[model samples]
Target: MRLGPVLHREGAFGGAGKRLGLGWDVAGTVDATGVATAWGVGDEVVALDHGMVKPLGTHAEYVVVDAGAVAVAPRATAAAHAAHAATLPLNGLTAAQALDLLDLAPGASLLVTGAAGAVGGYAVQLAAHRGLAVTALARAGDAELVRSLGARHLVTDLAEVPGGAVSGGGVDAVLDAAVLGEPALAWVRDGGAYAGVVPQSGPDPVRGIRVAAVEVAADGARLAELVRLVDEGVLTLRVAETYALDDAAKAHARLAAGGVRGRLVLVPGAGS
Candidate 1:
């Protein structure tokens, strides 16, 4: 999600970006019974906000997640199996929200950039499930991955696409998960909509299109819907690679390499 350019000058603090940087969304285990009275110890959770008061994170073992931010992990989803799902909730929610802004009804066409990444994964699936024709654009070797998510069309290069999409007809909306600054805006269909994890420089719809950034928030009800998809086998989590928590630096390197193809998770010690 696009973070606000927080400005702290003198004794005054102000947030830049209309609705950016709501907070962080994280996941971990409930180490205590305090924050969320409804949550309990041993419940695998995903949460939003800061750990200090709002939402505890999953950056470590035995994290103190806020109860309001917690959700029981899908049955059989071992906490140690992957961090993909742990990191998925926030990004997935962001993409779902952005797609909804397009207001395209079922059977409409939608385009997605960076289909190989975490948030991009949910974009493809949700759009498809809503009966929209999904066209996924990603790096080479990512075609098959996005295809499994219900994308009808796929492309390796944006240059190969015409009219803002691979199908040559363009799509009703463009979900630009891979923000590359200003030049990336060219992918949106003329008079359509553009959405990204980063806020667009132009707030208004360009060429009669709508443009906006996504900020993920806490929503148990939405999380349940996503989990239901996983339970029913409509959605699948992909772990590109795993690393020990101590090797988080290495994990970051792998993620920056750009061909990892899925979520890179950190595993705690003792074979967790």
Candidate 2:
């Protein structure tokens, strides 16, 4: 189980007395298989349950996921494991799909807000790997972190972005991972693109800029590629903390308190 921003929001303000399950990412060994499925019992796997409202979530010890949504887990390395792999499905896919939406070519200038956050960090790494000129907007303290993630430029303040980075005097596109909305949109050149993480809630298009929010979908093939990247060291994973699955409430509280640098994972049968 993994803690995500959406899970925090849902537990905090998703209304009371509802029995909705609250998780999207899961990594574990397959305990069973259905007829005609390619997966077998005992396959180490990772999957995204992919829904805002569901009767059951991936937070549990056992979860039911579509065969198409599951991928072979990353081979454990000295620095990573199922906990790290758990952080990949939702956040990694969101970044990859958002980049797909932006559709920028190599050498195009791009800005990513919240560059230190989970999705934003992945966006920085993936965008740089694709050869985009990435300017990351994150806290002053995170300059080194974002830089290590492959950001070509780092800005503590949005106003620090240089106008000459692009031919149009603004970034060719903006991946608004911080959800700065209109403020972030202002940094995009006319006729450029903007991609937000929230589905259908992005700012309206202006200055001929194309604006769209990513609604991350489950893609096992794409997820497998990401897992391979992790193994190849093309991608990095960080786990901020771990908790026993029963301590979910405490985990949620920590998430609400903010300042988490990496993902908080819930380990089944873990101690305190």
In candidate 2, which residue pairs get closer than 3 Å at backbone N, Cα or C atoms, i.e. clash?
Answer: none
- How many pairs of residues collide in each model? 2, 0
For model 1, residues 1-272, the per-residue Cα lDDT tens digits are: 23221111111123333322222444556667864297777667665453122222354655543455556565546665536556567666777788877778898777787777777888898888889888888866777778989999888877665565322346677777765434445656667677766543434455666777765566776776776777777777777777777775676556655555667666777342
Predictions in order: lDDT:
0.64, 0.85
Across residues 226-270, which tens digit of lDDT does each residue of candidate 2 receive?
Answer: 989888887888788888899988988888787788788888878
The C-alpha stretches of model 1 lying farther than 4 A from their native spots are 1-28, 49-57, 80-84, 162-169, 181-184, 199-205, 270-272
* TM-score of each candidate structure, all chains considered together: 0.79, 0.92
